[model samples]
Every structure is written in structure tokens, then in C-alpha cells.
Target: MKIKCSKILQYGALEIVAIYFSLLMVMSLLTGNLVYRRSQSLLAAAIIVVLTSHLYSDRRKYFITWGALGTLLASVLYIYYNLNDSSQVYLAIKYLSFSLNESCLIILTVSMLWQRTKKFILVLLLILALIIPIVFWGYYLSMDAWFASDTLLAVMQTNLGESKEYLSDYFTVSGMAAIIFIVIVAGIVWRNMQSVLLVKEKKHFTAFISLALLVSATACYKTRDNLILNTGWKAKENLQKYADFQKMQAQRKSIVRLNLQENGKQQGVFVLVIGESQSKDHMSAYGYDKKTTPWLGEAFKQDNFIKFTNAYSCHTHTIPVLTYALTAKNQYNELQLENAVSLLEVAEAAGYETAWLSNQIKYSAWDTPITVIASEANQQDWINHNIGETTVSNAYDLKLLDSLKSLKLTDKMLIVIHLMGNHGSYRERYPRDFAVFSDMSSEVGSYDNSILYNDYVVSKIYEYVRSLPEFNCMIYFADHADAVEEKLGHDASKFVWPMTHIPMYIGFSERFRQKDAAMVNILRNSQDKVFTNDLIFNIMLGLMNIKIPDIYEQENDITSTYYNSDIQRFKTLYGQRFVREDLQ
Candidate 1:
């Protein structure tokens, strides 16, 4: 019944190899990485064969029996904990599962190699353990780099330079400390094992040594692929193709010039407000239960404000939507803006002083095409004047008004105001006073509060415009609608109509009303079901009283009755595409 030291070493080696193999399989399964799974399986099988051979030769029952039992229990616990979905600790357990599985492999490897040529194998495993963590950290760094810059910087508190500095500092200190600790522990274990091992025990240690080599090899391979993908060399090539497509399409379209028939006939001002992340379902003006849009509702009841019932954003995200909306295109697939121009550029060409005021952060604007147009037109101005405790509060729509007041409003000018409306986490977007409904405790309630704050901000802007004598006309619509209900813990991936549905409003001054009553009624009664974003170029042409180009004449005009039916059929066929191309 007595155990030989050599037999004990063999049994321990087999147990360790089995535990390591199990952990590798579990890690691969949990991470859902096919590459890792295939590589680990190859290495795990090699380790298992070497260890099992030694186990069969060993006579001692105690070491092999107890070690096998312990391995089984650990593997079972790992699988069970991960499978339970209802538990609150599920996410925490999932995050730590990979690390825990790796630790189990480490423990098994070290224990099995404790008796034969123990000094050498112990030292190797220790150094290898340190390398394993460094490799994992490198993978994390690579994945972070793969994501877009806007996404990465959005979560960080510091500016770009400071954020990079922080990440670099964290990696250097943590990596060095972990490597040093592993080396010191290995040295101690190796020295102690040297004093205790017999010469006869040396052959049995080969099994454990092979297991250490297998793990090190797999980690290095995975880390190498991770680094390559993160460099984004391929993504840049794809972007170039998209840009080329846009440029080529623009060149194909013909340009038509407009001339003023009579100078100083009747000067007018127009303010176009572009809102972000607003849903029509949350607005009281759209018949929602919450009084989020009380002021807008009252304003609509008066004959001044005209509301469009079925406006929708072309895309879900800002970059794609704005690119298409401003360029007179739908998505990046088709380029229609060859000789075409943005409404702002058109207005400027018509001898109007144009200005673009925005509450969005300066960097976000700089990253997009809208800012490029703003810069080219020399009408750039940001309204992020407040720098308070909360970053979100500093850039609300009200700050845009502050910037607007400083500008000189001429009789013939066009002002574009871009508002940051109802972007989430909804609670952070609004003030505490906007929390009107007492029963609203969930994410939906927070969204309601955000909508209320946006309504208040819109009312404030409308009041400012109404008080100004030079400002005669104002047009307001959301840049895109949001997934308000889905954002409140529901499925957000399912694209719904309400997610894209937006509200459009137009207000005319007394002077404009009296002078252009016939034209005003034409716009008001127009039953056009045209895509809202695509109407930008044509509407601008109509407002300026310019002759329509060959391209424009071919497309549906919002001012005509025939235009309405054609747009509906177009919408039914190509959806947004017909509007983007035919209309442009």
C-alpha cells in the first residue's frame, strides 16, 4: 500500500495533464473563439498522451485517485456556474471564468512537476506562466485598437493624448510586476525541488515539461493573430473604395445655375434646426401620453407651426445619415451629389450669410463631413460654452441659443442649428426637474425625462426666433429617430418604424405669410410622401425660386401634386434609394 516517490510523480503528472486539457476546452467554448479551440485541442491531446503513459506505470493509488476526483469537481463547477442564466452573478462569473480556468491549469502543471527534475521544469513553468498573462494583456490591447476612435474615446475621461498615456502606463507597470513575481516564485520552488528529488525521478518529469511547452505555444499563436487584425490595414482600403464611389457619382450629375430676377424684392431669414436621437413616439405633439412636448403642441394648434406627420431618418447612426442627408444621397452605396450641393452651400451662393451652430462636441463635428462643409462655407461655430461637473450637461441644446444670440442676424441669412437631443443613457441627458412622471422608475422612465428636456429646449429656441424681427421662417426636424422602447432593456436590433420616425415643423413670420400666401399654402397642403432627407436639395431650389436643373426636373418636386404620388411609388419600390437618387 506504500507509495514510491517515482510512482507518486507519475500519477500527479497524469492528473495535472487532464485538468489542463479540460480548462483549455472550457476557455475555448466560453470565449467562442474557433481558432483558439482548434489550437488548444491539438496541444491538449499531446499533453494528455504523455501524462497518461506515466500514470499507467505508477502503482500508487492515493495520488492518482484523489487528483482525478478534484479535477472532475472543478470542471463540473465551472460548467454549472456558467450555464445558470437567472443568477445575478452570471456576468461576473462569465468575466472571471477564463482566468479561473487558466489558474487551474497552472496549479495542476506545477503540482505534477514537483518530484522529477523538479528544479528545471518548475523554473520553466514559472517563466511560462508569467508570459501567458502578458500575452492575454496584449490581446486586450489589440482588440481595443481595432474598434473605431470615436468608440474608444467616448468611454475614456481624458483627451486623446491623455487616454493613450493612461493605457500605456497601466500596461507597463502591471506587466513588469506580474513577470517579476512569477520569476521569484519559480526560483524559490526550483531551489526547494532540487534538494528533494532523486536521480531516478528525472524520466517521469518529461510529461509535465511537455504540458508547459504546449500551453506556451498556443498562447503565442493566438496573440500573433490578434496583433495583425488590430492594425486596421484592411479597413482603410475599404474606406478608400467608398470615397471613390462618392466622388465618381458626383461628377456624373449636371449643375444648373440660378439668377436673381429682382434685387431686394423681399428679404427673408430661415433657421433650420437639426436634432439628434429624438423619437416621435416620445413627443406629446405626436399624441404621446407624457407632456414632453407641451409647448410644441400648443404652437402647432396656432396657424403658425406646420407639422409633418411621417418624417423618418434615412439611417440609424449619425455618420451615415448626415453623409447621405447633406450630400443629397441615400447611404454610401450610390453617389448622387456630383454637381449637386448642400442646402447651406446653395443658400450661401444665393447671397445669404450662412451660419452653423452646434452643441455636439468639437471633435465629433470635426470627424464628420458636415464640419468639412461648415469649414468650407466659413460658417463654423460651436455652442459648448458650459464646462460644469457633468460633461453631458455642458453641451445641451440651450448652449446653442447662447452662441446664436452673439451672431448678427441679417434680413437675408440662413442659420443652421444642430441640437443634441435625447441621446442616452437617458438619465444623464436631462435635469432632475424634467422627471415629471412619479411612476417612471425604469429605463423607459429615464427616456421620458430626456424627451421632456428636449421639448423644453425646442420651445426655448422657438421663442428666441419668434421674438427676432429679421428671422421670418424656421424649419425643425430630427437628424434621426431613436430606439427608445428597445433601449429600455428590450431587443434593439429589430429595426422598427418608430425607431426611424421623426417630427418635422415649419414656422413662418407675419411678413412671409402676407407676401407669399399662395406659395405658403402650396408647401403646407403638399401631400408629398417623399423621403424627408432627400427633399433637402429640391426644397432649397423651390425656396430660392431658382430654375430646376435637368436632374431636378426629372425627379419629384414637393410643391407639385404629381410629386406626391410619384414619391409614394418610389418609396414603395426602392424605399430610401429612389428619394436619394431620383430626387437628387
Candidate 2:
């Protein structure tokens, strides 16, 4: 037991440094501060301790064991607290835990084998210990500003738009920080080499660590819910998601989703206008008391349009909802949803030239799932690329018009218009003159006015498509809805109706109606059917009048009389699903 404890103490000293550095990194993550701020001062103090190690010879005996235990304890605490996938605290917990385990294991193994190659093993151990601080310090400089997001991780890898430019900026910012980190690391090693030698063992090592861990446990328990720790985990998870998405992209090319039979000569413009953060319950067209959708109500009066009263978004957030909505995967096929070919790809395979136009943003530190879906377009335009969340943009949904007009004319075109819709800073979503709901409360009025602005944008697009000589049809649906609860924006919710109940409409030009009156009648008859947006690809396929084998379900599509709705089938706001009869 004495021999074993001596071996542990000798090698465990290295693990102590690992623990100290790991603590700095983990604490920095918990506080949502840069590693440099925590590490630089910590490293300097460590250097001072090492330079005067001869004066603290008695303290060295028991320090390593306590550090090892403290590090292990800290890692376990971080892992225990950040289990929530969405928590910002979840960000760096995964990597930090893995690194702690790896560092401890390496030190223990190298220490056990110290008899045969003591000098070489120690050198290797020393180099490895330096890695913990060196890499984290550089990471501090490069990824400090980064929030854990699929888009942020993707920005590091892709050549698309401003994401690549962000990476270029990363190189420039990390240069000076890297030099300072190396210098500090060098100073610590120069002064600490003698102390890294054999240290005397003491009996009270475990007692010291126990007290430290007890104090640490209390601190950990107190700040157990800090959201920043998940930031790193967010980046890590999104990177995995991005990888899965890329794999799906590759596999999607070989999906061979060509329709077996054609309904007719497929030549016309099929427009899919996707809106953001808009709740149907808030819109007048969907029975809201306010005139939030006056122009949309006008379109509703026309015989060429069908408004679906029972449409719900699959997910509360924009990215995930879009993943299922624009793809062939529905609730039943969600397990294989990542591999599902996108609607744009399906339209292209069905022999239509595709275009994507967006008014919200192009990229925000990452290639958004919507951006990946839009990548399938032959021509794509993003009107605004600003990365600020609180930005009061002068840009409006009407800017999508310029992008639409820029597209080269093709006989059979599938154009997707992604709108800002009722996204927050609602007042900024439209011009001040369009604030028709100003008489209402400020928050509610701004939101209602944004909806009113969306009504005009949708009307203009409908009119534009109708003016085109070719047979034209358009479908508009929000990506997801928002809850204006005390003026709060939409977030991940377990049971919220306002955040998922989005408005959907299908509009056909007179020429399109003349050519496909049967389909128009089908759409009108099925408007009241309750369905989730996950199965919306079926509706989109119906609008394009081309169906892929094994993916389309007539029973779930709003354009089919066979459309079925049960309490369990289309899960809505809460535990209670939408009933078609109740909708009426």
C-alpha cells in the first residue's frame, strides 16, 4: 500500500497541473468568460509557486493527490449539471470531462512504467501536460466569442458567404494571444522542472482532498444551472449535426427520388413562400380579432386560394422545424429524416429550375439548416447577412422581391421565398408607416403590424406570380410561430400553442386553376384538416403536382379528401392534438 501510494504521488503531480489548468478552463466556461482572463493570472501564480518550490517542499508531498481528486470531482460535477442538451453549460462539459479522463489515464500509465525509461517517459508526460494549457489558451483566443451552434461550427468549415470570412478573422485574432500563451507556458516549465522530480509522500493526502471537494461541491451545487457551460457543448453537438447533415447531403444525391408517373406536362412556376415566427392565432385571417392580415383576408375572398386553419409547425425553433418540413420525412419517417431528400432536390429531379430568396439572413456564424436546404437551389439570394440578434434592421420582407426579380426566367421554376415574417424587434420588420396597429399596446401592436406587413408581402408575391403568363401556383407557410407572452419571443417549448400554430395558404393563378381544377378543389376541401408541418413536404409535393414514391401520404396531405386527423397523429400545442372537427 505504501509503495503504491508513493507511485501515485510521484506521477499524480503531473495530473495536478492538468487538474489546475482544467479547473481554469472549466471555471472560465462556467462564468462565460474567456480562458485567457482566468488562465493568464492562474499560470503566473503557478510559475511563482514553482520558482520557489524549495521553500514549499513540505506542501508538495500531499498536493498531487488532492489535485487529482479535485479535478475528478470537478469533471463529475460539470457532467452531472449539464445533461440538458439545450443548456449553455452543456457546451464545454463534454470536452472538458473527456480531457480530464485522458490526462489522468496517461499520467498513471506513464508513472507505472517509469522504471525502464524514466527520462523519456517524464519528457513525454511533461509535453502532454503542456498541451492542456497550450491548446485551451489558443482555443480561448479563437473561439471565445463563439456560441455553441451548428451554424458557428459550420462557419469554420464551409466556403459559403461570411462564415469563411469569420474563420479568416479567427487566424488574425488568435496570433497575439497564442504568443503570450507560449511565453507563459515556457516560464512555468523553466522554473518548475526541479519540482517535477520525485516528491516525498505524506499520509494526509486524502484528508486534504476530501475537504477541498466538499467546499467545491457546495460551489458546484450553487451554480449548477449556469447556462454558459452549455455553450461549448452546443458547438460540439451542432458540429455533429452538421456532419450528419453533410452525410445526408451526399446520400441524398443517390436517393433517386424521381416520380414514377407524371400527372401532366409539368411546366409552370411553383412558388413556396416560407415565413418565420408567425402564429396563425394572432392573424385575422385565422380568426384573430385584429386585422393583422388584411391583404391576406382579401386573397382569402378570392376563389383561387385556400387557407388552412389547422396547420401546426413540427418544432418551435426555425432550424429543426425546417429540417422536417422541407424534407420528405414526416413524423412516421423521422428516424431516417436526416437522409431525406429536400423539396428543392425533389423539384429539380422533377424537372423544374429552382431558386431560393431570403429576407431574414444568409448566415449567422454557421450555415443554418435553412441555408443548407436552400443550397439545393440553382439560384439563391440572401438579402441581409447581419449576424446581430438585437439588430433593428431597416430591411423588410419586400426585399425578397428584388431577389425574385433577379432570377433568370425558366419555363418550369420552383422559387422558395424565405421571409423575416414576425421575427422580433417586430417594429423593425416593417416601415413605420405600415404600423396600422399602433393604437394597440406597444408590444402587441408591433407584432400585429409585422403580421400586417407580411400580408402585403404575400399579396405582392401572389400578384407577381399571377401576372406571369405561365400557369402559376404558390404555397405560403410560417417556419414556426411565436408566443407574445408578456412580449417574450418564441423558444423551445414542451406545450405551447402560440409558438407552433402557424398560418398556411395555397394560391393558384386563374391559368393554374383552369389546368388543375381538381387539385384546387381538393385543396379547398381539405383546408380544415389538422396536420403538423413535419408532413408538409407532402403538401408541397401536392402543390407541385409531382409525388415521390414511398414518401407522400395522401391521408396526411391537406390536398386530399383522405386526409385523416386524430388526437395522437398530429401532435399539436400540448398533450391534446388537433381534432379536425374541433377546428371547424
Candidate 3:
């Protein structure tokens, strides 16, 4: 009996093998984790593809249509991976596989709607047309940063005006060219490949395949951390988690009690200044060659000031760092962020009027966890308004200090000032007058200028706070550091030791210094010891002499006698690795 070639090719068995094996080979080559479990995932994915192979009866059309569109999408990923210096090879391959899986999904869905394939395809194309622009924007962003869940959160947490401003700043010539190229290519593909269609199949078969595909997709999402499975879904998951966190915080706030001991005066002010993307190494006070921190350098001479020489941020991203830093959660603690009480709550419970003055956006599409924590304060002042969700704005950090003057200071106040200091687009962070560094063209120069401006802003804030009749103590620390010299932002994907080395210092008034001599001495001695911002909650409590025994561990507080400087063992990036080992 002669084997008919048509029978063999009718079900697209050869096409399935060709496409599946090619994808598998590419993915396997990119990653070292081709172990038994991962292999099982690959096998399961292949089975789903095989089950759906019958939909593509016209093998030629299937290849042509998806091939053209896939290449276009692949080109963007290629550009992104090439531009993103920190992109690991395995992750790139994982994303590539995700792209193929996403294409498979589109194909399966379109095939199921065989009666209206053309209409479905048209609708899909239109959707892609809209989504592609955002993808293009991300590609341009990848030039200086890696895409992450945090990046998505920031994007969602911005209004249209800010989003437009962000696009204008990062949108480049290459991005425009790429968009034009994709549009022209996509138009040609759509015009020519409109005839592609799935075979007329039974409704029962279609339903079965659809269900199978759904299960396959769910399994893949559960097992793999890839772009297709993770991006939007991960962002949604984070938002839900934050919602849960808000609920938990609401419950915890009512029961939280601070152990406060009033020394002499019950009426005093304490200020916490949170800086943005500032590296301690860039400051002259930290021994940088440039005098970018003249004011801080001068402040070092004051007996009341104590600068922490060895401070690290637990995470390089703003949300994670701030989430841990502002709350009773740290790298060393097992407390879930959702359940932890924030510094604002602690301060509020202690009968101190808490104010959150920020040069950051008040709210975006989604309220970031940081925003939720910030909202817990009795009084809130957002100076930036929505000058884009990012710190790349003219709002400047100094405005926050000015806003402080407007607040009705109570007898006992806890003021938290969040600055937009030295974030990205460093030139925009400061005015021309602060551009003391001659070479404004270079990244190094612009970054130093921003630092210099930050120093001035912070010093001015210090002077104003110190001059206040009731102000007694102040603490300043950055969310995370930037590798300005290396032309790198504080992206966790490309994290370097310097990215965690943020500037941290505390100052006391002469009256306050005399009141808490032992606390001041403890902090002074612990300055040279290793500290991470995640424990800022503890130290803040220590400053107010508030002790929640279950939540606040004395060892983590720099102001405590039992304070431990052994933070080398602390982990970051969701406790995947040790901070010290990463430093090494």
C-alpha cells in the first residue's frame, strides 16, 4: 500500500514538529535549566501544540501569516535584549518562548472562530496596532533600563499628562523608525495574507481544544516566569496584593501602640527625609573627588551630625525599598509587608501629628504600595502633582521643604519628606544654577550636578528644620542609589554594589542631643557599621523610643544598645541572595 503524502500533511503534523522543535531548541540553548521539570514543561507545551495542529489545515498559510507577525514582534525583543545590557541570556530566551506561546494563543483563538476568521484577524490587528506603540515605548526605555514589574507599576501609576511627558523624554529616533517599519511591514502582510483560514472543524473538537489550551496556558504560567505569562498578570497580582496589604494595615493601625517615654519636653518635631536614586559614593562627604555635596561636607564638621558610612538599600527599586523601609518589615524579618505597620501608623498611634510631604505623584492609575503607606499620614502634601510618575521633572526636591512651612505643626509631629532627588534624566532634576559641573553633556557631569543640587536642597531643609523652634531631630536617607558613573539606573536586573550604597545621615539639635545622649552615641558608633534601609522603621521607632516588642527587634535598630551591625547576612531581591555576597 502506497502512503499518501496529502494524508500525512493534512493534519499539519510536520508543521507542528518543525515549529515546536525549533522553539524548543532555541529555548534550551538560551537557558541552563533544561532539567527534568523544565523538560516536562516543554513536553506539555508541545502536546498542546500538537492537539491544536489540526486547526491549521492550510499549513502554508499558517506559516506565512504568523511568521510575518512573529518576526515583527521578535525584532522588538531582539532590539530590547541587545540594548538592555543587564538582560541575562536565559531570560531573553524565556521571553522569546513566551512570544511564540502568545502567537500560538492568537492562532488557536482565531481558528476557533473559523466562520469569522477575517473579522477576528482584523480585530486582532487593530488591538496590536494600539498595543505596539506601548511596546515601542518600552523598547526605547530598555536603552537605559530593564523592563520589570516595578516599571509597569510606575507606568500604571501615572496620569495621561505625565505619561505623555515621559514618552517625549524617552521616545527616540530609533523608536519612531521601528514603529514606521513595523506599520509598513504589517500592512503589507495583512493585505497579502488575508486568505489564511483554518479548516472547517466540528464544534466539539474546537471546544475540547480550547479547554486544553486554557489548561496548558495555566500550567505554563504556574511553572514559568516569562514575559507572556508574567507581565500584565504579575502587575495585576501585585495590585491585588497591595489591596490586601491595605486591608491588613487598616486592621493593624487600630491596635498598634507605641512605647513612648517623654524626656523633658513632650512637644518636639522629628523629620525624615527620603531621597531618590542618590548614591553615597557621589557625595563629597562620602569621599567622592567632586565637591558635589558642599553643604553635607560642611555639615560633617558639626558635632550634632552623624553620617552613616556603610548603608545599603535592601532593594534597588523604589517600591520594594520604600515598602520595607517605611513599614515594620525588613530583609531580616519574616513579617509579611501586608501585615506590617508603617512608620506613619506608628507615629500617629504615638499621638504625633504625622505629615507626608512628597515631590512625587499623589496617585496614578493604581495606588502604589508606597502611596498607600504615604496616605496613612494625617496630613499629605504632594508637590509634584503628576509631573509624570517618575522623578524626571522640574518639581525639584526643594519644593517639599517649602511645602513643610504650610503644615500646621502640632506639639508632637512626625514629618516625612520624600524628594525627587537625582532620579533619571539627571539634567531635569536641578536648575542651571546648580549645574556647577562644567560638562553638562556627560552623564557623569549631569549626575554630579543633580547630586550637588540635592546636597543644596537637603542642606537647606536641614537649616530650615534646625531653625524651627520645635524641631528636635532629623534623618535623611535615599530609596536607592544609581550607578551614575557607569551610566546605569537603579534597575534590579543590572544591580551593582553601588546601586545599594545610598546616603544616610542623622542630625540632632543641641537641645535634643543633650536630652538623648546615649541614643545619639549609639547611632554615632553604629554609623560605620553595615545598615540597610529596610530597618529604617526600627530606627525611627528607636528615635521616638517606641517599642513594639513583637514587631520591632532591638537588634535591627541602630539606636539600640542591642543593635547588630551584622547586616552582611541580610538578603535582597525577595531574599534570593545575600547583600554582602552580591557586594563581593
Candidate 4:
């Protein structure tokens, strides 16, 4: 058997076409993008045309081998750069590893189509063995709980503008199935080749065997480097980007020092309850049909709870929202300046024993300066409770009550309680016993129950605050709202601005209420439809009745507006400014 030019051309075209098809199939499985499928087909057609041209001219191993190696290497490097630069290296490796592992099986199939024997079976098994390590690598990169289907879907939809459902349904399942299909196809090709080929054609099979082994080796080595490069580049980029962002942020940070003119004013205790993932729309207090927030509704009607009718959170996520809300710049652009003085720091400076108790895991991390300010007390005395122990559960807001009880409050105390209220999966956030509604079949019932549980927790906190003789004022608001459930056709994780709109209620003790009646009424009627999270700093200033410096008083001062406005100007000016700066 002599190596004919036509035969070489045919095999080379087949190899290129097979590789292209495998790439497209894997990409389609990973991204579920129709455009990618079309692109893959076009590229494969081009490769076929080019190979046919080469065969028409003369048989050349150099063109085929070099082209295959170059294209594969370029693709691998592109995937690496995108993943590394975007702080999504894990996902990059995951998708690439799966693609290559699947491609190896495809290579085996193509190889066996040319020549099959014990050698082909051995090579197939070798590739199959490789799949285990690749799969394990994918799993290792996805160690975080947020990488779960629900969480990742939400995150992808928010960041990428594509629903996780696309990735989950088509990409993930189909990719795995395609990999298995390739394995099966390889076995079939091997059996078919063995039946067709005899001992006389053995010499002709050498080129095909060498091509398969070389392709597999190249892919394996490239995939390994892809993982290493992605992870290494990600770490370097994060540090550099954070440092650059911090430098930019520092240029704009002009911390205002309060000038205290009055010396004899009596110091009082205040509590700010920061609720997590609670939507005002679900609360009866906000006129929802369900009586989920009965206690809060009663409190609001009685004028005990001075409700801010239109208040929105700065950001959707806990870390971003908490950071922005507490910092002087309650916007995303100023996120790098998170270490700047917060309301807690201001309160602490004013001779208040500031204590922070949180049910959030991330809040316990010392990386955040706001967390440090909140949990300034001794670690032994600080309450870092994890109430949500179940797989899909969130901590009950009532858990904060026990933590609060442990704290020794002073006359001038600023207690910041970060509650795990209504943090989803909705059903797990609440107890089964709280499923009072008859219509328990639907997701709405679960949400209503979760809202009710949150309400009950709020009531308990209120009762505790009311019992405290030294506690003069209290402010409560959720960090952000929840999205509709998964079954509702809406992405349950994408936070709408309306979803970020939360209820802000402030209450004062009888004595403090009488003394600050004018200020209270001004706050009640303040028409400024300012963002609630931004009010943290100004509210602290107002409560302490201290004069803030001119530099901090420039941008949309809620206090200056008497907290009254239906302008919704916060979105237009403040929102656009941050977006513009972020892009720059």
C-alpha cells in the first residue's frame, strides 16, 4: 500500500472537518448560542475547501499538521485571555476542559474511522481515562456554593444579559451528552475499521495513528496550560485592577468632619436594622393583599413607625449594597473607597459604643472595612451567628434577637444588626409551620410564608427595641428586594431597580419623639424621593444634629430636601454618573 496524494488529501480534509465539527458541538453545548454553531460550520467548510485545494496541488503533511496545531493553540489562548481578564477564569477552564475532553473522544472516533485494531481501543481507553481528571478539574473550579445552577444562572443573567437557563438546559446537559456520544461513536468506528481493514493495509494506517496521537497530546498539553495561565493571570489582574481602582477612588474621597457646636445635648441609643433580600411589595405594610407584614402595618398606621414611602437600595448584592450604603459615596463607582468613614465610624466618634451583629457569612470576613466598623467589639463578644444551616435556607431574622440580648448596651449605643430576612430559596428561608395560607401549591405561597416569617422577626426586633429604656431611636430597611421565583418565566436572580426598592421605617421613643416632633414631621413629609441607602450618612448627621462639612453636602443631600421629593432624580444623575465613571 503506497501513500497516495488523493488518499492523504481525503484523510486530512476529514480530520479538519471532524475537529471543526467537534469544536462547534462543544461550544454549542457550553454556550447554547446558535451563532457559535453557524460560525463553526462556516469555519469547517473553509477548512474543507482549503484541504481540497491542497490535495489538488500536491499531498503535504506540513500544511495540515501546522494548520491544525496553530488553530487549536490560538483558540485555547483566546479562551484563556477572556476568562483570565474577566475574573471568570474558573468558567473559562470549565468550558474549555469539557470541550477538549469531548474533542479527544471525537479524535478517537476519527482515528478509528481510518484504522481500527487493539491499538485504537487502547487509545480510546487512554482518552477516556483523561476525561476523569478533566471532569474533576471542572468540579474543583466550581467549589463555591454560588456556582450552583440557581445562583450561577442569576449571576450570568445579571452580568452577561443571558439567562442561566440557556447555559443550564442546552449547554451543560448537551455538552455532557455529546461527550458521551463521541465515546460511543469512537467505539463503533473502531469496530467498523477492524471489520473492513486486513493485514495488507496495516502500513497505510501508520499516518492516521500518528495524527490521532499527536492531536490528542497537543490538546492535552494546551488544556493543562490553559488552566494554569487562566488561574495565574486572574490573580495578577485582580490585584492590579483593585489597586488601580483604589487609587482612582482616593482622588475623589473628601471626608467631611462634623463640627459639634452644642456640648450639653443628651446622648441617646439608636439601632439600625439592615434587612437582607426583603421586598416591600410582599409586605402588607406596603399594601400587599397578603397579611404577611401585619405587625409592621399596624406599627406604620399607628405612626409609631415613620415609613419612607419611596426608598431604594444602592446596589442589589449584599457586599456592594452594604459597602455603598455605608460609605460617603453611596454609588458603585466609589466602591473602592469602602474603607472611608461609615455611619458607624461617625457614631463611634460621637461617643457611641458601636456594635455589629450579623447572620451573613461574608459580613464576618475582615476584608470589608464596613464589617470591621460593625464588629468593632472583641471577637468573643461579637455575635457572628449562622442561622441558615439547611442547604437552601436563610437565617431567621429573629436569630438576631438572641444575639442582641448578648450585647451590653450603653446609653449612647449604635447597634447595627444585619438580618438574613427573606434570603432565598424562598421556601427554605421560612419554617414549614409558617405555611398558614391554604394555597400552598404555588410558589407565591412559599414567598408569602417567607415574607410572614420575616415580618414576625421584625416584630420581635421591634418588641426588643421597645423594651430598651435607653434606646431612643431605631431605623430599619432592607438591603434589597428579591426577584420573582424561577417558574415565573423571569430570571429569579436579576435584581430590578423596583426589586431594590425597600421599606425604610424609623421609630423613636416617647420622650425622644416629643422632643424631636418637628424633625420627625419634617422627615415624614420630606418629599425627596432619594435613595434610602444613601441616607445612612445624612441620617446619622441629622440624628446627632451635627453640622456636616460643605464638601459632603453637595450631592443630592436628602437632609437638605427635608427627605421630601418625588423627583426620582437619584436614578438620572447619581446612577448615570457612576455608570459613566465605571466605563471610563
Worst 10 residues of 1 by lDDT: 144-153
Model 3 alpha-carbon drift over 4 Å, by segment: 1-20, 32-57, 67-105, 108-121, 125-141, 144-146, 158-189, 198-227, 258-267, 364-366, 387-395, 582-584
Query: How displaced is residue 352 in candidate 1, in Å?
Result: 0.9
The parts of candidate 1 lying over 4 Å away from their true place are 1-266, 331-340, 364-366, 385-395, 488-494, 527-530, 546-557, 560-584
User: For residues 1-584, what per-residue lDDT tens digits would candidate 2 score against the true structure?
Assistant: 99998876675566547645866666566545544432333333233223223223344532453234224324333433333232333334433433333333333333334566756666666564454344434444554422223333433433333333333434345645764756564444333433433332535544533433343333333333333344445666655665577557756756644443463687888888899889887888888999888888888898988888877777666666777788776565544656777888778778789998887565443365567778888998877766443233436788788777778978899888888788766766888878887688887888888888888888888877777777488888888887775333453422345777788888888888987788788777777767688777888777777776676678767776676766456664222345333344
lDDT of 3 by residue, 451-472 (tens): 9999889888888888888888
TM-score, cand. 4 vs. native: 0.60
lDDT of 2 at 128: 49
Report the CA-based lDDT of candidate 2 relative to the real structure.
Answer: 0.62
**What's the TM for model 3?**
0.83
lDDT of 3 at 177: 70
State which candidate, 3 or 4, has the greater lDDT.
3
Q: In order, what lDDT does every prediction score? A: 0.53, 0.62, 0.72, 0.53
Q: Compute the lDDT of residue 449 as modeled in candidate 3.
A: 94
Task: Compute each candidate's TM-score over C-alphas.
Answer: 0.56, 0.63, 0.83, 0.60
Clashes of 4: 8
Score residue 463 of candidate 2 by CA lDDT.
74
Question: Tens-digit lDDT track for model 4 on 267-381?
Answer: 7777888887777777888888879888888888766568877677665555446655665555423444434456654555456677777765442234344444454432223
Clashing pairs in 3: 157-364
